[model samples]
Target: MISLKNITKKYGDKTVFHNFNLDIEENEITVILGESGSGKTTLLNMIARLTDFSGEISGAGQVSMVFQRDRLVPHLTVRENILLINENADVKRMLESVGLSKAENLYPKELSAGMARRVAIIRAFSHPAPLLLMDEPLVNLDLSLKFSLLEKIKELQSTTGKTVIMVSHDVKEAAYFSGRIIVLKSGGEVILDKKRVSEKTLTETLLNGQSI
Candidate 1:
């Protein structure tokens, strides 16, 4: 499990989280949901140890992250990028799983947006990390691609048993992927924290601006 105690993050004069706390269980998916600029990404960065904050976090193992952007190497082929992280990674298998078998030899510049995102996810999973952090990875994808990628993610998580912490504004995505849902208000206050409920209930909570 991962624990965050008294997490306080600030940017100059503006504060994001003050004495915020959370606990994430191992081998489970936790979704942090909030609107843009609500400090959702900041919270993930803190857990990933990618950002500095005044807090104590424990039980986090090695982490692999997928950002909002694909962030693939423009000069490297899709397989090459995955190999860069894990030399013995099953690049072909991963590509095939995401229906990108033919994209193994293609560079990022030659791949579609959804394809690039798949490569990014595959690269992150290829690493030997026990924890995976995702920052709104499905943001701009079409609905079909979004559901497809979500299935891929579910498969990867179940196969690897990696602990996942994802931040997103999409309630349906949250309902579908998360075992636990944490809704944050602006300035990083957790307005709702509960076990997975129906998508309709989650949507109603968001629309009603209610906290639980």
Candidate 2:
């Protein structure tokens, strides 16, 4: 399990989060929803150990992430990029898992935005990380592609049982994809907390974090 206590972050005198506390089940997927500047990305960063903080944090797992921006190696083939992390059989299994088994030889520039995003996701999941974090992973994909990829993501998670934390601007998507939804209001207050509700209810619904 992951434990966060009194987690607070500030830039100079402006506090982004104050005394925030959260616990994430070790193998369960946790989806975080918030508007822009709501500090969702900041929270993900802190969880990934990419940012410093004052609150205590603890976990027993390897972590990897797919950021809002693709961090592909421009000069490397898709396979090579993923192999950079796995360096073994783990790469082949992950590629097949993400539906990218045929695009192994392609370079980043040769692929579309959605394709690149899939490659990044595969790369992150190929490692030994027990926790995976994603930030707006489907932002550039068309609806059909997004739907397809989301399934692929879910399949990978179900297969691996790795903990997932995704930060997304689309609450509907968050509700549909995650088992638990955490809504962070401005100033880091968790105004909404809901547990697995039927996805049909969140199709056009604006969840206020009280459903949980």
Candidate 3:
């Protein structure tokens, strides 16, 4: 389990999270949903220790992240990117699992936007980490592709049971997880938290900006 206590973050004089507290269970998918400046990405950053904050977050050991942007090495091929994290990784099998086998030898420059995103995802999952953090993992993809990638994520998580925390603006994406869904308002406030919810209710809560 991951425990966050008294999380207080600030940028200049504007506060983001003031005395915020939350606990995330192990081996589960928890998606953080919120609007802009609602501290969605900031919360992930805090957990990954990419930013500074006054708080105690325990049980997040050796975290791997898929950033909002696909931060791949331009010079490396798809297989090389995954192998960079773990030399013993089954690069071939992983690529095949994600329908990226044909692009294994291709460099980031040669890959389409979707292929590069898949490579970035494979690289993160290949890393030997207990916690996986994804920021906007499914952006700019078609509906079908988005759900397919979500299934891939589910498959990986089931096999490895890594604690996955994702930040997303898509309610349909949240509905697909069938796990913990958290809706945050401004100041890192949690307006709704549920394990299972229909898209209609989730949309309404997000639109109303309050718990129903």
Candidate 4:
């Protein structure tokens, strides 16, 4: 399990989290939902130790992150990028899993957005991290492609048994996972937490601004 105790984060005078605490189960997909300034990304960064905050975070060892953007190297091919993370990474096998076998030697510029995103996913999973943090990784995709990537992520999580923490704004996307779901308000307050909640109920709860 991951334990976050009294997490206090601030940017200048604006406090994002004040004595906040949350425990996340290990080897499970946990989707965090919130508005723009609800500290969703901040939380992930804290867990990844990418940002500074006054907190005690444990069990987040060797985290790999997929940011809002793909953040791939423009000069590198899809195969090279994944290999950069793990020298022994099965480049062809990983690409084949995501139907990118033909694009192995293709640079980021030559690949479509979805393909680049898939490569990023493969890179993160190929890393030997037990904790995976994804920040809005599914944004700005068509419904079909978005769901397709979601299924791929689910498969990776199941196969790898990594503790996955994903930040998402879409209710449908959060509901897509069978693991735990956490909803946060602007000040980092958890308004709702559940497992395998229906999409309709989640939408209604978000709209009503009520805790469940």
**Per-residue lDDT over 82-181 for candidate 2, one digit per residue giving the tens place of the 0 to 100 score:** 8888787466666776677788889999988988998998888887889999998888689888888888888888988889988887755776675888
Instruction: Name the weakest run of 10 consecutive residues (lDDT summed) in model 1.
Output: 203-212
Off by over 4 Å in 4: none
Report the number of the highest-lDDT candidate: 4
Clashes per prediction?
Answer: 0, 3, 0, 0
Each prediction's Cα lDDT score?
A: 0.89, 0.81, 0.91, 0.92
Per-residue C-alpha lDDT of model 1 across residues 84-109, encoded as one tens digit per residue: 88999998988898889999999999
Candidate 1 wrong stretches, greater than 4 Å: none
TM-score for each predicted model, relative to the true structure: 0.96, 0.90, 0.97, 0.98
Whole-model lDDT for model 1 versus the true structure? 0.89
Candidate numbers, best TM-score first, in rank order? 4, 3, 1, 2
Kindly give the stretch of ten consecutive residues in candidate 3 with the minimal lDDT sum. 76-85
lDDT of 3: 0.91
Better of 1 and 3 by TM-score: 3
TM-score of 1: 0.96
**Candidate 4, residue 204: how far the Cα is off, in Å:** 1.8
lDDT by residue (1-212, candidate 4, tens digit) is: 99999999999999999999999999899999988899999999999888999979988878998999999999988888888889999999999999998999999999998888889988999999999999999899889999999999999999999999999999999999967999998888989989999898888878876787
Q: Using alpha carbons, what is the TM-score of model 2?
A: 0.90
